[model samples]
Target: MSRRRRLRSRMLALVLVGSLAGLTAVGGPAIADTLSDKRAAAKKQEQENAAKREQLAASLEGLSAELGQALLDLQAMEQRMPQAQAELAEAQESLDRSQREATLVAARLQDALDQEVSIGSTIEQDTARATRIRESIGQMAREAYKGGGTATSMDIVLGAKSTEEFIEQYGLVSTALRTQTNTLDELRELQAQNANSQARLEAVRGRVQELKAEADEKVVEADAARAQAQERKDEIQQLISQQAAKKAQIEDQKAAAEAEAAAADAEAAKIAAELAAIAAQQRAAEAAAAAAAGKPQAPAGPVGGSLFANPTSINPMYVTSNYGMRLHPTLGYVRLHAGIDLRTYCGTPIYAGRAGSVQWAQYRNGFGNQVMVDHGLVNGSSLMSSYNHMTSFSVRSGQRVEQGTLLGYSGNTGTSAACHLHFEVYVNGGTQDPGPLLGR
Candidate 1:
């Protein structure tokens, strides 16, 4: 390699050594635990279905016929904007962390490769040194054989002219023997070191392969995180845009909604009110019956369980919203949905719930084209049923009708938005939950 390239390689190899050493010193499990915790937390947030539902339901439930509904729309929008903004912030943070992880993984992969290259170089040097040692040792042995091995101590002493000459010959032989011994020892040490480095190089290469895979996964995770963040950002922006338009819409509908509510309020109260028209009709009917008999009246029949047939045009009736006190999520005010709202199309047939007298079949103030049917005495009280929000009526007041008598056509009239049948069951005068009565 060129000088510059070699220098760069060395630098990278040094980085690899330091990084790997740190990892080894800390231990793999401890290092993995930190990243594992973060990843687990991010994965946990993947189940955001409930949050999505809350957002969707809140947005949809706010638009209805009541004036409170328009006001509800505003409140729901207020709640959603802030919630979306907060989620967006979290998503952005997660994206940032994932990107950092990707970058770290890329660096580690490169370092592992550098460590493998550097270790391979060390192994080569060791092999070269061992070869040189072997050649040198071979030459020394051949020279020794040519000279007939070594002079004995007795031979040295006898051949010597003086004590100094004997000492000098002994010293020369000792130095030659020591040189061969040192060379052989060094060759053995180099061979052992080279084997160790070869193993280490293989391990480094394996680690490089592992790091490459981890790097790819990190890249994918970072991209997904970025997409999530972007999606949240776009959603928040859309909500912001809708916020202004919704507020303007509420202002436009405010007067009409208010008028509708005002008209419906008194009639709505009468459904559950003690001083209701149904109560008066009940009292009058009982008096007329007693006078006809000229004796005490018979005990009323028992009323429990499913007391009425399906009153909707649907083959099998389906209730859209149940009868209960529904509190607006944002407004925190409870409103009574006094009856069950059934899924009915515009101009669909509306049935009498049971055999009864058709008392009123005209447009009541809030009920639009309303039809009230008196089911007569039941369980010592008068039972009545009302089918409201119809386009037109077929029956009139004082008409005797059998069960399933077609009274009107369903519509989106009065304080209603969509086309449906609002069915109410009143015992004596007060309206109650119609679930039990409606179920067949």
Candidate 2:
């Protein structure tokens, strides 16, 4: 906006030069044409400034909102990070527990397998011993049958040669029968022990298989827990990285915004100084006029409470942001807002706050299309009010306007985050809060 204004001022200078040249050599018609051409150029430049100002306003508006959203997202991510960490920890613990269980089950499986193998070996040995004993008994019975077919006590008595010989044979027969009976009973006991060993081997084999399956399941559980922990860890890391990026971007944007805002502030101060000088001149001119007519000066102090009415068509006006210092959330740097932001939709009608002369209805840097009203004097002080960031104005510089006269339409035309009215009140050429001065 300022650049265009400077260019326009330069163009006006060129026109002045042309006018001087025309005065010396050219006729009145050429001077008129030169003036007309300059006016056309000025209007074109003003239009271009309006376009650029609106474009700048639109582009800059979303930054504050973006910063706000980025800050919110960062805060939410910070809050979520702990929860994700806790979930990862919980998963890690689960994996550890599962691994421990898998190890124990594997150990138990090995033990059960060893036990089954031992029982099987024992069963094989018992079967071999039983078979050897049965074979020995069969060989003995075959030998007795092949030699005499009978070794009973009756046969021994019948075959005896003498009384003493018969007695010895009878004793031999009785001892042999008793030995056979004991041998058969031992074989039967060995068979029964082999059967019990086989049963125990089968039980141990089943237990070994069961342990193997349990160990496999524990291993699977451990793997699943490990995967879950890794996933959660990755999610947390990604979230942290994204939040960091957003914060950095927001900070960079805020830095740029702060710079722009500072420029706007300086511009406002310059404008205020210029207004003060103009007011001093106007006051001197008025004093001269009044003295020439022998009239008293305007009232010395405020006779009424407030000198201005609400500069808006909206009833029950609302304030969006108060005129004061605004602080950056992370930067901790302060910037002046300089004016009260009133709630006004785009194109909302803006009315004159008090009867005054319009200083300018044009774009002024970051303020966009603005209207400054110099309400001569109030409460023995120079008073002024400005309506900023308007879509368009109905009044022009030096135009007399009455209180409640339609001035312009509110807008988001310059350095605004949204559609609203930046209303400023000045007392003795210094900015003051407009809230107390504006009518309720």
Candidate 3:
């Protein structure tokens, strides 16, 4: 054989050996179509899950808004209740005070009336006494005139036997005259006093009447205020009841959302398991081919020659770095890497390794433009994958997307040495080898 032919045969033998070494790692070709069908179905399911998540998020937000409004309204009602109760209590207390005042005034008026009656009786008695005294004086005058003017003061005085008796008689006569004059003056004074007392009693009676009237009006107003306050209290209670019902509804919604998320997780796990099985079968086929060729095999990891498509298919032999290595290009330190870096040109269209829904698409710290996808259920757990270091991103949060959709263009935005895609697969929340499954 020619020297060039010998080199070519040796290279082909090396390729065959590498294929056999990786065969048992994945599924075979007999289930390729089945696995593809399942992956398509899983993609559709993931899209549905994305839509459901959006709906649940919106519903939760609306419930939160309503709950907040209800709480505010309840607080307002609670604050008003105290004021209303205070007003009602003040009104009631005022009514009570007025009623008590009315009672006191009525008692005072009764006392005044009794005093007026006593005064009137005393005036009547005084007037009767004055009349009797005047009649006695008139009779005395008639008798004296009948006896003619001969019966004088000197005769009257001489009628006494001794000088002391005559002086006594004179004193008695003077005292009678003064008593008559003073009696008339006293009668007039007593009448004036009685009139004043009656006037005062009337005034007191009027005040009592006014107080009684005011008390009745206050009672009426207080009753009305109490009734209004009671109505308001009842209304507030009704609102509280409605809020409780709304809270229960929100709880129900939350439960449903949690259940949907659980179902999506379980479904994703199943799909991941199926994809793993198919990949194992394909790897087994490749390994069988390598054995028949009889050549040395390469290590089972990401390699340039693989069946998977890349963001840029050109220069497939160049690998930027291995996944589990150390060497921070930007920070200049040895750190364990979580994902493989594939070298590619800028603006390369990144594709999904397996079917999945767009879980997240946004700019993140240290990742710049990135996209994470939920592939499907595998082994009773959800499998997720991430594509980072992209120049541009098209998907949005809560967006529904399918496999093979244009994620973004490749770029070196994160901690990278060159423009490449940082690919990662997560199995049950832990990172796994994605290169072999992608046939890289």
Which prediction has the highest lDDT against the true structure? 2
lDDT of 1 at 11: 35
Clashing pairs in 2: none
lDDT of 3 by residue, 136-209 (tens): 76776786579673334787576989889888878877776777678667667756765775676577667645
TM-score of each: 0.56, 0.49, 0.33
RMSD list, candidates in order? 10.0, 25.7, 32.4
Model 2 regions lying over 4 Å from their true place: 1-73, 162-171, 236-251, 260-327, 334-440
For residues 11-47, write the lDDT of model 2, one tens digit per residue: 3332232111111111111111376785785566457
Top candidate when judged by TM-score against the true structure: 1
Clashes of 2: 0
Alpha-carbon lDDT, every model:
0.69, 0.71, 0.54
| Residue 208 lDDT (model 1) | 74
